[model samples]
Target: MSAFMTKTLKALGLAAVAATLAVSAPAMASGGAAHPHAPKEGFSFEGPFGTFDQGQLQRGYKVFREVCSNCHSATLLSFRNLGQKGGPFYDEKYKNPNDNPYVKQIASEFEVPDIDTDTGDAITRPASTSDHFPKKFANEYAARASNGGALPPDLSVITKARHGGARYIYSLLTGFKNPPKGLHVAEGQHYNPYMAGALATQWSGDPHHVPVGGVLAMAPPLKDDLVTYDDGTKATTHQMAADVAAFLEWAGDPHATLRKKTGVAVLIYLLLFAGLTYAAYRKVWHGKH
Candidate 1:
């Protein structure tokens, strides 16, 4: 072949490679956009990665409050109750460990509340809304009792006051299934299609069909032998689900305590802006007539 022809063919090959890269770039960047089982930050649940281990939750909380909190607010959580059951928002458990300064700082900031058994009241002053997050469940029975068969969700801030919110959150959490057998999952990553690519576990057909992992992820976090409660109540998978769901529900709705204040502030701002706009309009037209 002539040198000119060879150069032309090389250019064409380069263009083809570029085109192919462009087509695959978005897919590579977004591993799990098409599937429902994608894990999103703050929204995804880590299941096969592991169930709701209290110790793990503590670490997760550290990750959330330290890293994720800059963009996302757990406005549903209170600053006071971080150490208690609902979330690992506190760090006292690792006070003795010299390696965990993050845990030590969180634990040092506040005191944990003890519950009163005799009258069924909090033995200590409740953590004020500004202090930290509240316990997800006052107890297991309490967690189950809230939802009318559906688990009562916490709304410290993020709940579906409008359309599609609940479904979006639910789908992201439970969407991880078995990636087609023997698929490799990277460390610190959970299996999810909505966030990851199509693993062997995700099959086509019915979107509503539960993935191979389980039906609704909200169902089982605590199973027999999974978690041990101090109160002697078996921390069954259902109970863990109920507890974490309740805790998340609380995290999503923490602003309930300040809803009135926020509403009033918004009302005042709107009224003032409206008045200013009206006055400005009148001034502009005042010279017309």
Candidate 2:
């Protein structure tokens, strides 16, 4: 079998096992108490509690670059945009030395087509086109082949698309504990309740879940300690999970901060306008009363 097919079958087998296990997990045998894992209510990704954590966002960028970028592509992002206040795309001087080589190599491999101003001939290099990012896999077929019959979905908008978005991501990263003693994830699948349709070998479809920076299925590409922060934040797994979640949240909504700012301004303006109108009415009514 081709390596890709072999991996796919393995993943499918695991998925079957996980599905059975998930189905059999004795549906909370009671109305007495809520299961800790029960779905949360009002889980919208808005409001103050779910607000983007800047510190976490910065760390998340470190995790993404250090661990998650191996098979996944942040083609939607740019090296230059890291300059935004809470963006993970920090400037060169602030980046860790170890991550530089691989990041640069990957960025350089993308072919960017450009017109030579003098000759006007189109040329391609390690960059993207208006319609496409550099191919992370040799082709789309190769990407699908590598995972179970599924292609690794582009992560650019994953945080935004998933049901829980931020919490779901954070939980998945820290969720890969040893499945209950009797429960072994079948050969091909991974053991995750959150990834409803995940392949066995495709834990969260990316390898950033291991105790280290990344996981074993794809190897821990971003091992702990790979990055040291000038801000003195200890690079723990939890911190990494939180930061990357924040960064991806930003990636999913680059204008989130701006939108919040605008919302506050609009609210303030309405309040001021209301106050002035009320005062004007009172002044006119004073003599009438």
- Candidate with top lDDT is 2
Q: How many clashes show up per model? A: 42, 15
Cα lDDT of model 2 by residue, 1-289, tens digit: 3365456556655654564454223233122111223123322224532345555566677677667765677667664344444444434564442244434544565565568888989876564212234446767788867765455667788865665566656556655544433333554444444444423243333344321211223322334566786578887665666567667768877766666666556555655665565576667766673
Per-residue lDDT over 115-136 for candidate 1, one digit per residue giving the tens place of the 0 to 100 score: 7888888675533434454445
Give the per-residue Cα lDDT of candidate 1 at 88: 46
Looking at model 2, report the run of 10 residues with the lowest lDDT sum: 29-38
Error of 1 at 17 (Å): 44
lDDT of candidate 1 at residue 235, scale 0 to 100: 49
Instruction: After the best TM-score superposition of candidate 2, give how far the Cα of residue 181 lies from its true spot, in angstroms.
Output: 6.6
Evaluate residue 132 in candidate 2 and report its C-alpha lDDT on the 0 to 100 scale.
36
What is the model-wide C-alpha lDDT for candidate 2? 0.53
